[model samples]
Target: MSLPLPAPVSTYFEISNGSDIAQVTRCFTDDALVVDEGQAYRGHAAIQSWQRDAQKKFAYSVEPVGLSRNGDRLTVTASVVGSFPGSPVQLYHVFDLAGDRIRSLEIG
Candidate 1:
């Protein structure tokens, strides 16, 4: 089942699940911030690098199972399956959107 997320959020997941580096890069703002695996990536270039590195390390799939909103921030809980220590695990992705682009995202 899919949740009705914001356009940018939905686009983010779509491109991310497909592991399209270029498209994924387009979903974020120029100064977008992403925190993942205890590392902080700032700016589009850094975020792109992070996404690429993660994709190269693990072939993964994310299914958004839950969503909650607070002002401009949206929290998404997803079930992720991939080539990692934990084959499948649930993760919380907190996203802050700026218009149709993602301003920041923290995943754990």
Candidate 2:
């Protein structure tokens, strides 16, 4: 599905839950940047490649719990269930939105 640009928190939840690399890429601007852990991915090409690698390495479900906005920044806290088993892990995503697209995303 083609989502609204910049997308809502639920949109992120859906894309992450589905682990849809294409959908995730569509949520960002052409020159967006994503920082996860200590790695940084820039632009749509790099982001798509990163997501593909991540999907293959990690099997998990991402459920968004809450969303908060401060100016152009939006933060989401989500519960993640890894395929390895055990309790669900918590992940925090901080998004910097520009116009209708995501300019930057920091995930931890």
Candidate 3:
């Protein structure tokens, strides 16, 4: 069964399946921050750059296997298979939403 995700979170995963960088950025707030691999991407410009860099570096796909909430954060546990060092890895995506958009996300 698929977990029920919020609008922006749902959109994030949906767009992530493809290479639509603009759609991915649209799921976040104007001042959103995204952290992945110890690098922080602030705002759409930085986020776009991050996405582009990742796309250029690896060919990968992510499948969200679980979801849970903690306080104001929603955490999605996903299985990611990519061209990186670890072909398959379980990642934690913690999202903080503001209204219909995501305010922040930390992926590990």
Task: Please report the candidate that would top lDDT against the real structure.
Answer: 1
List where candidate 2 sits over 4 angstroms from the true fold. 1-9, 84-87
User: In model 1, where do residues sit more than 4 Å from their true spots?
Assistant: none
On a 0 to 100 scale, what is the lDDT of residue 49 in model 2?
Answer: 85
Instruction: Report the candidate with higher TM-score, 1 versus 2.
Output: 1
lDDT values for all models: 0.87, 0.74, 0.86
Top model number, TM-score: 1
Q: Give candidate 1's TM-score.
A: 0.93
User: Each prediction's TM-score against the native?
Assistant: 0.93, 0.81, 0.92
Residues 25-105, candidate 1: write the lDDT tens digits.
567888898999899999977877887787888999999999999988999999999999978999999999988889999
Per-residue CA lDDT of candidate 2, range 1-108, in tens? Answer: 232324534555666665466765557888888998799999978877887776678787777676778899988877788775554878889999886678888998
Better of 1 and 3 by TM-score: 1
For residues 5-87, what per-residue lDDT tens digits would candidate 3 score against the true structure? 98898888776666488886668998899999999999988887888888788988888999999866999998889889978
lDDT at 59, model 1: 94
- Residue pairs with backbone atoms closer than 3 Å in model 2 (clashes): none
